[model samples]
Target: MIEKQSLPSAPILIESIRSIGYSFETAIADLIDNSISAKATRIDILSIPNEEPYIIIFDNGNGMNKVELEEAMRLGSKNPNEVREENDLGRFGLGLKSASLSQCRNLTVVSKKDGKLSAFSWNLDYVIERNSWSILEYSEEEIMQLENIELFKDVETGTYVLLKKFDKIQASTLEINKTITEKMSSTIDHLALVFHRYLDDGVEIYVNNRKIESIDPFLTKNKATQAKRTQEIKIGESIIKVKPYILPHYNKLSEDDLKKVGGKEDLRKNQGFYIYRNKRLIIWGTWFRLSRQDELSKLARVMVEIPNSLDDVWGIDIKKSTANIPDIIKKNLYSCIEESVFTSKEVYRYRGRKENNSEKYNYVWDRIKTRDGYEYRINRDLPQIQLLSKNFDKDVLIEFERLLKNIEKSFPTNTVYLDVADGKLKNDSEMSAEEIDELIMAFEDSLNKCQELGLNVIEFYEQIIKTEPYCNNEKLKELMKEKIKKYE
Candidate 1:
């Protein structure tokens, strides 16, 4: 038999995964994941930036014991290739170690369970000094030092991770703290929505003493009264329930409103889909490959919730803040999301008519291409009398005969034309001067009626005459001259 030799202890490679690669946002998100998994109903995140910036993540959840605390600090010790329970929030179990290390050189976890308090800490400098992986157990005196910390007082049972010597935070000064607070305020607002049901309890998440407010991108609170139709669909075995909401038109939204129902305005950067894994938000913004189209840009936020077991399907990384939706789910999601977009677009179009008077002229109005010039198209087959003159106005119709008479002398062209098949104008017939005046008066009266009905007759007529000039007949000048003299 060959002699079996034991291999030397493998040196702990210190350079492989340093704690500086992860962004501050991703690191904080990871810490929150642990809290959520612990069944924390309330979570408080506190950051004090100064000469020595520090971060504290406190949660009201089942705390860990001494042994569990020690094991939790050992990197890569998580049981591999093992199936987790349905309620388990951990997938790879590297979140706490990796996320904590990525943000600070020193990490301390304090917890109370079974009527006992225990704590564990990992000091990177100390590990590098000894060139080994070791967890420092908190002494009775050290625990006393932490007990005085405000966040730890009055907590029945929970775990708190204190990140100090924040060498990884991009901004560590007091000035930077202001900016971080602003950014975190927006981030927490979105988080509240991701785990709304959990946060709505008496437990509150305070950022700098201000409670976080949930901003529902779907406008579910106001949607009941404003939505025209609401539908829900149960998809696949996951029972992924999709709630389709059709929002009110743009006009219905308050003039001072910053959010529009079913609109993507709420999903950009700080406001999009808040992906939650086991009641913790892991991602924000649109999932890769899914973009906000113009029609859907206003209503793009669609929150997707998955149990921790589906972490592999979502490509959840160790940071627990970014994820990629699998192709299987994306296939079904595309159709549902598309339908929601189409519904919103139709509602916008229909409600626009009911709310705005200008919508009625959408078809006939010549959208002036330039201040000095205009381009017009008569899409309808109706006879049109477009006036390219600068003086076109509603009051011009009051002196319609006078204006036509002036045109007969100055331009000597038929200011009006007859569309033999169209109802816009009457057919021209041989008549005495008196009869021509009556006809002109009747036509002018009809146009004034259109104006009263809020129709843009001037714009409509401008388009028609520009497309089909009134001088279709060569004798149109003579007819105009006769009508002008008779009117005078």
Candidate 2:
């Protein structure tokens, strides 16, 4: 038996790992994970886009010493299976190097601890030329030349990460500034949502000095949000907590609210298990194949909190963007998924019924459940329409009925659904005074017609007060009530 040392060629292996499928946003998030593990309270991301653009991420965390920073810069710094502090978010220890190198040719990190500053950088070109895994250590005077290294001077313990020489990004875009600006814009959104719970807990994350606000998927603070009872699944000294939430019906959600929940187009896509590892979102908008995504269940979102101890069982990948649920966990999640989906459908159904059977007003449209789904048909029997029919001759009345059905059948459900999903639906605000004036004339004409036909004008006005658009206008309803009282 014999043992031989076979080291991978530095340049080839480094270039290969650079293609690890990390999008611009995911790469930024991976670096933040390291900051969070270091117990950073405030993290600042600065991107100066230009011909020679650079990115600097500064965090006020428990900074590492010279020896510690050397080990941190090394690949495979920590074992994936080893037990760590519950708050530590690192796994595989490849995130610092892999994530940084995936975006840039030069990766420099400066840290301040115990009144001493240490700086190191891994330059891809240097590694290739040397044909070894070597990082350049900077002297105190040399370290001062690094961008944003002064950021650590004010703090006793903090780290500053600098990224430069975006060769990969420059290769794809002619307008480097515009491209990096766009990438940073999306990276802000990704951090806001992925680290939303952390942001909500007093952690400050700034991009270009602008504070980033958390985007809570469940909208738990909303008055209309329905939160189901939480269920715990215990796995040998560990607990995975599952809490379901049904977002408010779309009508109750304003356009601004839609954006917070991933925009209208993605509302359905973002509905599912929001898996969080120690309050940090790992993967989301999935049912783990426990259920399918559908219109009825679009508002259902289940928050699953699993401690990192169960990382092995969940099969959390290096990127933390994916996790596989064991069959045992999947079985336990079935009932939770079913309940959340059913409740979400009830919210949808309730919105439909709100315009149908509620005692407040007579809805002009009837929501009918079809084999495929629900259909909204005009309620031809609405009192206003019924009274108008009496004035028509037999043939004319029949044609009028056909006309209503045609309008119903020609309903642009698909277009309306898309518009609503995109948050582009027309807002139903109070009508202007000019619009109300027009309604007045139309109401007076109908009232006069009722008198001429030997019909009860007061009774006619009664039905009008309880019907569609008229019922929605308080001013019109008041005027109609006055007319009815005058007749009485």
Candidate 3:
């Protein structure tokens, strides 16, 4: 078989590139990726909204010379299989052109390097007129005359991308200026989250001269946020880092706290795995079918960090908007999913309670979940049980444990549910003076028994006050505290 010379029609290919599934926000983010990879500490995005609108992204990154600029302006500058630097964010090298022209008809790029400047542009009208893949190169004087080219006047080295003639956006709307303004406004939030780590580490991004604050989705700084230990998964020669974070219970979070990672709406929408390639978020709010998104796990968010070397293994797409998790990777992440999901459930289990931690609260009953179903068992750690266990012998203790288990198994769940549904669940009556005196006498007897068994009387006294029935009766609690002071 001989290879024949067959080329894609320039006009058709250009239009095809414009339809490569890029939204306005995603297109701007794609261009910013190039800036970050260039080691630029600061990036500025400027939008000019008018009848013939244009947008400019200027970065102080290591700008290219004439030849490098020419190559970068090409459709496919670098092969995907080629090895890139550890920090390089480019995958198919089609981001700059494809992302820019996807929203506009004309794309121009001007760069400053080594005290010299160069500019080049791809005009869709000219390409369609000539029916050839061609670019317009500019002289020093012509480059100086370009709109917003003065942004690089004092820069040591940087690159400027200018997008003009938003034909598609104009065709879709009567008010082109307002639409572009809104699009840029939404892009700010996307950039804030996608590059949050970078921004936290001192890299600054400005939109229309306003500095954007990083939006930390994990709330890593919040004291209440539970950050599980980082786990590493080794594949071939690289290591994929995984760290799971459980957000605070909704009631525990303040309004300002919610605003940081967007609002309550974003909490559920941004749950699940957040895949990042070299500190830049690629995809998020998905479990990749490893797990389902449920209300119990809404607070769970896992951060999976992979390097560019493993790009092939992850199947990262051209837009970097989605990924495919391999079976091996999914298996390794099973433990993390189980842990984060369990913790998130616990948050709901104790919600609206005085204390969130089970160990801290001395509840009379324990609600335990098992594979079969939920079990409503009496709490065996109560002061009454401890006092009785200290006095009972081995055979007596065995009989007592069996009795407790039988009571737990015989819980009236259906009766309670029906009562609750019918609004007939009665509240306990207030304890009278006689009842308080009787409970005090019973507790004093237990305290005497604990002392006779050589147990710490003060310990038993403290537990008696914290335990229920006695804890609920304020009169009995005050009398017990007065009597227990002598034991202390």
Candidate 4:
């Protein structure tokens, strides 16, 4: 037989709830979910720079009446097991209270409906002193006296979540206003991404009077971004939509496009899956253990869409920032990942050369996969390489093949990958006049080698011009043709 025990003290429980691992961004995001669920078209986030720092999130949403406001303020007001509306962004009803108290000691809510206003507050200090789950309800006149209430006069029906005594943010800070401003900027980007679909659907969000713009991870607007095939998977009763995208090679992007997708983070780090629940981006830039992130696959990004019904199936956490891929869907996801990486690698290896000269040129190196693993070998099928092998002596051909293999074996791919990630790699497309001269010299050297091997000059010149590195430089190819005319 079990003995019944009394509940924990209100202060102790509130303290535990407030420390439940919420970053400032996610906490603010959870509150925004409430506004979105209320069908808010316009939401404003304000970080008032008073001596005592406070934050106000005001939304022009359908306001709650006195009873609904009381129910909304209560902890665990809605059971997670209960079926909610299809578009509701909330699960557990603890978001309003828990998210606000996570960052502040005092949480006050003022709501207006049909020309009547009601207010309620949860003060941790007051609850701790009283040793009970006590709430302070303010009169309409008292609510009007609040610091930011003057800004909410125009809204006839809406809700204001005012956070005061910002113990988490303002603690031990001399420049509190600057810290809040920085936090608001982060909030701006987080909301822009999380509520991007809603923003596209006419929902407006403003941070300190500045409008927030969506950051589309797919780069769908860019011409060079290749949209690959999409596959649909059914797990039990849920259907998951998967669309894979290979972003443009960095060289194909303009400076503005580079900054758009690249931002401060390396573009390589931005590869992998972007998980969305009901069109809201929850987690992104993850491979979910399907594959490793590498230089060749840096351009690959897959978008996975799941409905709220699959929350439990996907293992969505309270923070909504992480999700685990289900075993039932892993097989299909892996297949898609393989195809995406292959496409990404083609773009990465040739760097748009294949697109421009698809039928004319063959790369110097071929990527070979065997039971042993991946290896690189020189492409002996290139006409120039084959012609030289046929005309040259056996010893010379053997030496040349050995040199090619050694160069391929000793290629510092790992170091090059690190350099690419660190943004240390220079743009190969932009060639100075001196670089062009160097390219012409390399082309002339190849021509001279073919002649010394007793190959027909015209045939060798035509073959070499269509080969890798040379095929990519049309200007150098034309100049080399001029030099070959001089040889004749």
List TM-score per model, in order.
Answer: 0.63, 0.75, 0.79, 0.75
Among the numbered candidates, top TM-score falls to: 3
RMSD of 2: 11.8
Model 1 per-residue lDDT tens digits across residues 278-363: 55555655635554544433434555567665666677776665688777667666665555554444445445543544423334
Range of the 10 consecutive residues with the lowest summed lDDT in candidate 4: 367-376
Give candidate 1's error at residue 270 in angstroms.
8.4
Displacement of the residue 35 alpha carbon in candidate 4, Å? 0.8
The weakest ten consecutive residues by lDDT in model 1 span 412-421
lDDT of 2 at 76: 88
Residue-wise lDDT of candidate 2 within 297-341, one digit each (tens)? 899999999999999999988888899999999988888887778
Superposed model 4: Cα runs more than 4 Å off = 1-5, 352-461, 464-488
Report, for every candidate in turn, its global Cα lDDT versus the true structure: 0.57, 0.87, 0.87, 0.82
Comparing 1 with 4 on lDDT, the higher-scoring candidate is: 4
Model 4 pairs in collision: none
Each candidate: RMSD: 13.6, 11.8, 8.0, 9.5
Clashes of each: 9, 0, 0, 0
TM for candidate 3 is 0.79
Candidate 1 achieves a global lDDT of 0.57
